[model samples]
Target: MARLSHTSLWMFMVFLFSSYCTAKTVTYDFNVTWVTANPDGLKERKVIGVNNQWPLPVIEVNRGDQLVVNMHNGLGDKNASIHFHGMYQNGTNEMDGPVMVTQCPVPPGATFTYNFTVNQNGTYWYHCHADYCYPDGYRQALIVHDNKSYFADQYEEEFTVTVSDWYHELIEGIAPDFLSVYNPTGAEPIPQSFLFNDTLNSNLKVKPNTTYLIRLINIGAFVAQYFYIEGHNFTIVEVDGVYTEPTEAEILYIAIAQRYAILLTTKNTTDTNYPIVTIADSVLLDKIPSDLKLNQTNWLEYNAEAPHPQADITVEVASDLNPHDDMTLIPHDHMPLLPDPDYTITLTVNMENLDNGASYALLNNISYTPAKVPTIFSVLSSGSLATNSLVYGEFTHPLVLNHNDVVEVILNNNDGGSHPFHLHGHTFQLLDRAPSYGPTFYDYKDGSPVSYDAFNHTAFPQYPMRRDTFVLPPQGYFVIRFVADNPGVWMFHCHIDWHLSQGLGLLFIESPQQMQERLTIPQNHLDVCRVGGIPTEGNAAANSVDYLDLKGQNAQVGWLPAGFTSGGIVALVFSVVSAVMGVAFLVVYGLSDLKFKGKGGGVVEGSQGEGAGKEVGSTTVREAYRDNGDEVR
Candidate 1:
């Protein structure tokens, strides 16, 4: 019996230890402020920073842990909000943090607390969702580690490498001109330089003959980049926070908001430094002007060695690699093949020239505009579909969905330029793609030089690649599928800053009824709208009409009383004054009676018993006073 008791005690202790290790809480207190620093070699400009540090701060957590961030905004007059890119946010939709979509922007001198659970483990990032804020240096890497990672034993150490396209002028200085009506060419503002981890020439030092896991994140606002290192090859193990089958590549093509985990092994040769090159794809560039550099070079050194000769290295672009190829990416774990979709939506994407000559992007002939009140707030408060129409404009497209429905979306890119599309709150499975553009320039619209009858819906693999961001090539179409399980108002849009500002997006209203029951928005989120200078409106540049008409209809009233005259108006004023005085005198008399009664006066107390006697006396006095006044008049 004693031996059995000891065994039971050991089991109980083991259970407690396991539970304690599996669940933990991670918290961070961050202050968002402004600083002037030159990330590129160009001139210094004002940029937003977290904890007064540039490039923000990296957040690392373990799976099944709770992450709580207390963020205070101090960017003078700018409003800001942080979005955890690629996070499933699960039951915490308010913390998803897209300005004017999920909640209001955190105004200057305000604080917001983002608390959510880290259910999935992989690479992710966080950035400001406010217009042009992320491009102005409000971003950081977010890594969630898992004890059962697919390649846990493959590498000894890990490092995060961020690449971006930098500009000389701030977004505010460039947006107005680039989106002006007079700018008919629709030329996007070109970037002036490229950066590696917010530095002009960043170096990744390593030991010889060792394998390192590099987390590559493309946090750029506009261009997609091709990254590679001289004399080294890497194997990609993860993409957009999902583990994938290992695929070897010489160069990686990463789009904005996309992330990849690659294994890099140093050579056994003598210690030397190699060049890490990142070049902006000129295919996405629209009419590049002279004097702009596209290629950026950093260093990968071994044991603090000197840089090797440039002639010994050769740079290559990975444009030839097809992202939709079957062997490129497969699910690390087995995923069941999806059946026929419960909902299928076909969206048409194109550019339209407004009457005012300003360019705007459209989805199904309608441009999305943010409502005065947040959609989440409106839905929760009212639980009405009509609320969506009232808050969002009439033109805002809402893909209403029910819970657990398999949804398939066909994105037809009817534009002349490539767009990097990103979906919030969930990662979707890429089904298939069909390209229409080639050596011959194909028109974007139907009945043109191209025919889309050959859509490749049957060509998808058993387990498709899942990601949050993918390139929608010009004059091409792609299909993606996802289950409508996460309930919220999610924004699906192009990642290009200029294009998003021009309204190339739509809202996916998933399980509105369920969202109302599950979402609990704090008073702090509602308070953001009451604060001054915080933007509550959606992208206004996308509107076809720039101004609103506030005039009301006029009414006419022609007839009046026949005897009305100026002298009659004077007599009417005198009667009104007499009536007002009579009421005031009665009120004073009643208050005095109440005061006398309180002091035990017999006159007021006796009147309560003889009400008729008191009325007779007051009536006689009123009659006498009226007769005297009439005689004086």
Candidate 2:
């Protein structure tokens, strides 16, 4: 009878826990405003709340619940919005809520409601959609806890470690002139100071004997920055917004745009104050020779604070999980995952037109050229070559990686500037780097020697790191790998505001199905183009023989039907012109040198000997184009 009673009680408790896990309907309100209190004041002063408090209040909810968040803008000057990162929910596109992406900004005295569901269960965050120039105080943390039964015995306390960077400029409204700002030829350095949860100087206190889960997020700009608990080692169990096979480290370097959830149990140490966390600022081109000097215009000094070799915080050890003990915590099983393909495309950073009046840096061979018109019109218009033609140097267009392909990218920075290149929708592994760089295989290029340069390797014990966004240091490159398992038209671009506006971006389409589902080419978006099918006659009706061919044919360059007169064709024409001009000039110069040099005659002088010589060379170019059936411009 007692056994039966115990079974009944167990079933009843399970039912109650399941009910709690499945509860629905959660609503939250976030208000935005400006305050004028002096934080540096020595005396007590009243500090006004932008919403209703500082550091904002915590948001708590459970999985599988409807979430409706209303944002009120009281910040008299600018628009406002909120974005919940890494959450899956209905109305994802609508709820993406970036100020200009899906909805308009909330002007002063206005309010906006973001409605969605929390279908994902894990640690995630919510922050203002303002430009990167905004202050750190504007962002906050959010927790969607698992029902107690889910981790009834595993979880004890949750500690949110929201890392941030600080900038004195107005980050949000600094755009519209982004082109001017990120003009590769510009003179300004990107911002440098960083913080933890809006505090330039604050720390998290903990007792020695407890196991604490630390949710680490880099809502900042630098990539490959290492965070270390100097006297302690911990295990990393989750990356990005998902769980991972546990990895351990004392020093951890994270690529920009990534999140890691680490579990650390502190152990007691002697009464001496030991360093808990130390951050080492990364320097681009770390392997460069000390005496080497690139042109002043081609290299910039690393401006972040000197690496924090000294731990920033120290506290007394209180429990069995002491600062002195080494620990290992691995998840029981690996998460189920899909397979991917293997192909890598490298984005090399280099400079051109050296010493020329208008020299600029190039990714591949494509220069950063911002659209003269607004992005909205660029999205809608057909005549703008800048918007329609997706160019990646001399390489192929619309880089199509098949679904399930193991894709890797090497962002090689040859110029002096550092760029935080961000990929949308997915996170990637740092893999291994060139032997002369750092440690760990989390980041790597195609085939660097497995073993070399052990001296510098030991310095960064936390590498190769896992990250979503990583910076390409000046004249250096970062290799990142990931499975191209997600299907979509994902945007891969530099996170630097100006660089992105200036065309340092490209789209990576995963599959044909994904391509068709996501793409709305210039021709497809216009009514006239859709009606005519193509500019050519005789292929435009249901009964026409030509129409049947069009219908039956697989979509390819040949199936394009050749008569569209929008941006695509115009871009092709420009490309052709550029190519022909280049070849003509080269041939003319080559032949002239061959004739004048006479085995050893000076080729340079011969090509410029007389006006007639120059004119003859020009005439050859014109004749060459005429023979190719093209008119010389």
Best by the TM-score measure: 1
Best by lDDT: 1
Give the per-residue lDDT digits (tens) of candidate 1, residues 1-633.
445588898999997888678888899988999888887656888888888888788999998889999989988778899999999888899999888778888888988889999889788999998877888888889999876887889898899988888887778877776654434345677887778888867678887788899999988888888778888888888888888888887767787888999899998865678888777777677655577766777777774557553423233433433332322478788574577899998888877655444567788877666655565665565445422433344444667778999998888877767787899988888777655222222234233312134343456668888889877767777788899999988989998878887778888878878887888877677676667443333222112122132122111112225664434433453454456446545644564455244455544543355453444345533432221022112
lDDT of 2 by residue, 231-292 (tens): 56777766555555566666554544446677877666323333444242324322323332
**Residue 360 of model 1, lDDT score:** 70
C-alpha lDDT score of every prediction, in listed order: 0.72, 0.47
Give the poorly placed runs of model 1, Cα more than 4 Å off: 1-20, 311-327, 384-392, 436-458, 532-633
